[model samples]
Target: MGLKPWQKALFPLRSVAAVVRLFEAELRQPEPDLVLLSLVLGFVEHFLAVNRVLPTNVPGLTFESRPGPDPQTRLYFPVAELSIVAALYARFTAQIRGAVDLSLYPRPDGCSSRELVRKVSDVIWNSLSRSYFKDRAHIQSLFSFITGEEGPPRVPPGTKLDSSGVAFAVVGACQVLGLPDVHLALSEDHAWVAFGAGGSQTAEVTWHGKGNEDRRGQPVQAGVAERSWLYLKGSYLRCTRHMEVAFMVCAINPSIDGHTDSLELLQLQQRLLWLLYDMGHLDRYPMALGNLADLEELEPTPGRPDPLTLYHQGIHSARTYYNNEHIYPYLYLAGFHCRNKNVKEALEAWADTATVIQE
Candidate 1:
């Protein structure tokens, strides 16, 4: 989507020029804030394809792929520079409180470059995770699964840089400094930041090497075969094609086994089956329902509950919780049956749904 007029007004190209000037002037005797800001601006400039720095003479840097459960694009940085950036970012967060006012650029309300970076990180992180996960705890658990850790590290909470954290921080810092062309590409294996206008205008940085030369040709591995459940503030059904959903499940329940069946799982699967039916993906409904059936036959264990019991219990909970709105499930179910030529079943489901809606 195109940037709104207000967003463009908030981040004008002139802001980039101002930061570039600051970066050039402060290259010598660079303050922590200035250095961090400079790096952020530089990346933004590179993303824009502006010839701010000559290619042959650019500073020597080492490129590293971001480590996480999800797929991540590679990041290139000057060796040993991240420590300084991280420390500055931490200091910046200590000074700022509340929302970042980007209009006051170059020195927003006398906030230093360090403060700017922190503010940017806070803004971007909050926006990105708003609907996907609950809080830092969710992020922590997701990070742990990606790293195969028993749990997230016990770091005293404040701004500390890690492999996964720095990318978002950098993106946020760059964004506030007037490079508003950032985009995030999320997939089952990894998530990475991209730059430029989306569609034909979008561009992403990649390391060119022997093995990486054919990166575009690499095939994406399929996720779970069966339909999966996703629970946030509300519950939803997801398909294997839903890479982000699959990634979230694996991250949150890293050790979940046996079809990933649970009360939540069964409900989600049923929901997805109905959705597929409603969306006219008739061929997928049976496949999804079959997944639910498979779950039903699996023996109940301490962790893996009986699918049949969970299915009924889930429907009861949905009806009790949603009451009038509970027709959503039946609506999808009716659609599924109708599409599959089961006229009687469709009518029965629709009747139940209409009763609830009418009441």
Candidate 2:
């Protein structure tokens, strides 16, 4: 199989030198779209239907033969073209401004006040013409309006962005509106934004699990006391833009079928995570570290920390960032041990998770 018309349009990299060049540029890149990670993932997924890239029948996480081989491999990480990235950026920036009378929602406290956050949230939330069907599956990407898109056609009306996409959209819109104080807040299974000085205030920018009341723009106070994994026992990450980029990278979906993956996409994800990790972006994002650790467990990266160390680092991230209340980091470690049949270590990890729960 040769390059498809659209993939060719991306100017896909076919050599190792291209990877090195892009990786260096990426470390210094500012705008989210410039890296165009989301676009790259979306681009591969766009061709999946016609790809006939069958699932590898390999047993577990680690694969026997990786997707591509040597220099002539089909797997190439595409740095998104500047024109498309700029067009999407400008579109979202304009939408955020034109969609609302932003002056009416001033940041009263000289930072991201609760009202201003709410107004931004409302703009994204209300845009959901099909609010009732928001949880539909897809991948999310950057742009002022975060969203999930699938298939090769234009997104149909009433197709809402995934939950984090909504939160990212709010934060992104705020950024376009000139408020760097607003940043993404993430629990294990949900996403929102934290704002105000020192991120002292929190608000829901997207819907949570199914059948819950729409809490968009409401403060996340009571849930911390409710004390459930639903809220990570108050364990949340208030992410900087770099950390958010790591999350977006962590969220990349490369699955092709039951036991198959898009090798290029997975490789792209792994390399990008390493890039972010070296830049110290994943320090506060436990789950992203956990995600990288999982990949390393399957395909160990030389000159990098091993899977077990990375897993513990994720827990340590939870410890430092959220006072060790978060449990998913522990759970990730436990799962790893269990999978490797390290029963004793697995039990200890579970115990550590329980200790966090009891706190």
Candidate 2 lDDT tens digits, 20-58 = 345445556554432244444443343342234443551
* Model 1: residue 40 alpha-carbon error in angstroms: 32
Candidate 1, residue 62: how far the Cα is off, in Å: 50
Q: Best by TM-score, which number?
A: 2
Q: TM-scores of all models?
A: 0.24, 0.79
lDDT of 1 by residue, 7-70 (tens): 2232222332333333333332212232244233333322222222334553433322233334
Tell me the spans in candidate 2 whose CA falls farther than 4 Å from its real position.
1-67, 70-79, 129-136, 142-159
Give the winner by lDDT.
Answer: 2
Instruction: Please list all clashing residue pairs in model 1, or write none if there are none.
Output: 69-146, 70-189, 70-190, 71-189, 71-190, 71-191
lDDT of 2 at 74: 47
lDDT at 300, model 1? 31
Q: lDDT for model 1, on a 0 to 1 scale? A: 0.34
Local distance difference test, each candidate: 0.34, 0.68
The CA-based lDDT of model 2 is what?
0.68
Clashing pairs in 2: none
The ten-residue window of minimal lDDT in model 2 covers 58-67
